[model samples]
Target: MKSFLTILFFVAITAFSTDTVQSQTFPKMDTSPMDLAMARPDRNTPPIARVIYSRPQKNGREIFGELVPYGKVWRTGANEATELTIYEPLKVNETVLQPGTYTLYTIPEEDMWTVIINKNANVWGTVYKKENDIVRLETPARNAAAPAESLSMVFRPENNGATLMIGWDKTYVEVPFEKVK
Candidate 1:
């Protein structure tokens, strides 16, 4: 009985010690935390589309033409390449996008932004292959009403469809998605 008690005490100590070490070694919070945006007409309705991405702060730095350079493919937001999932068929720039998940990439310019929907998802950073592109559309960029400290994306309902509004710093762009006819 004494041996059994000794063994139990050692096991308890080992478990508590392991937990302490793990707590101390756990990774710190990411500088760019992941975020999610969904498209739905109302809060009670099911979402038509979803976007999972990371939000990186501006920190008073130039965003568009500098931090995210022009004429270069960007992952759209931050880490883990922006993921877009469509629950239904949608049309963008006259191209039909079937119901599936896709990676959203962008090429930002001074006045316009090229939105690319790639078949590849779950990619990290700016790993882009031209052959993997399913569709690309040009969207005009405009000045936002106010500066967005963090990169942000939201879906606004419009004309029985949805418009994805992306904003950072003082620049904003809109990508319209329509129901497939």
Candidate 2:
């Protein structure tokens, strides 16, 4: 009877261990990792703006106007909400946003896209609050030369500011922001 009890205990322990491992073994399926930063031309200055997001692949499927519909809030990327960290106060279009982290969201349209900076940095999927929006600016949407297999956000440095370029599939948009004096 003691041997039988020991065998049962070992079986239970193995089962629990297996369950724990399985729970933690979930894969990062999206795969496209993106990190973009805008820094001063001087080497001494640290990055003034940074963004981290997971990129989802096209996989031969329709993206803009279909997978991502128009006039709806998009999380801007896959997995955890796309995060933007600004170390200095900047003017996005005409709206001023203070230095802080924000979740980037967007509404895609054929002619234009509305880029949103939201106060909530910890959100998943398309869950967003309009009340939490810090600023929203509309930018022109244009066709890309070639289809981008994966989503991408790049920061193009300028003399006084930067342009945030977002591209996926065949569509792209640019948002300009400048440091506040």
TM-scores for all candidates? Answer: 0.87, 0.80
lDDT per residue as tens, model 1, 40-142: 9788988888999999999888888899999999998888999999999999888889999999999999999999999998999988998999889999999
Taking the tens digit of each residue's C-alpha lDDT, what string does model 2 give over 1-181?
A: 9999999999999999999999998677546565555545456877778888878889888998888888899998888889998888889978888888999999999999999999998778878999998889999999999989989888888888788889999999998879888
Superposed on all Cα atoms, the candidates' RMSDs to the truth, in angstroms, are 3.1, 4.6
CA RMSD (A), model 1: 3.1
lDDT for model 1 comes to 0.92
Q: Report lDDT (CA) for all predictions.
A: 0.92, 0.86
Task: Name model 2 segments beyond 4 Å from true.
Answer: 1-44
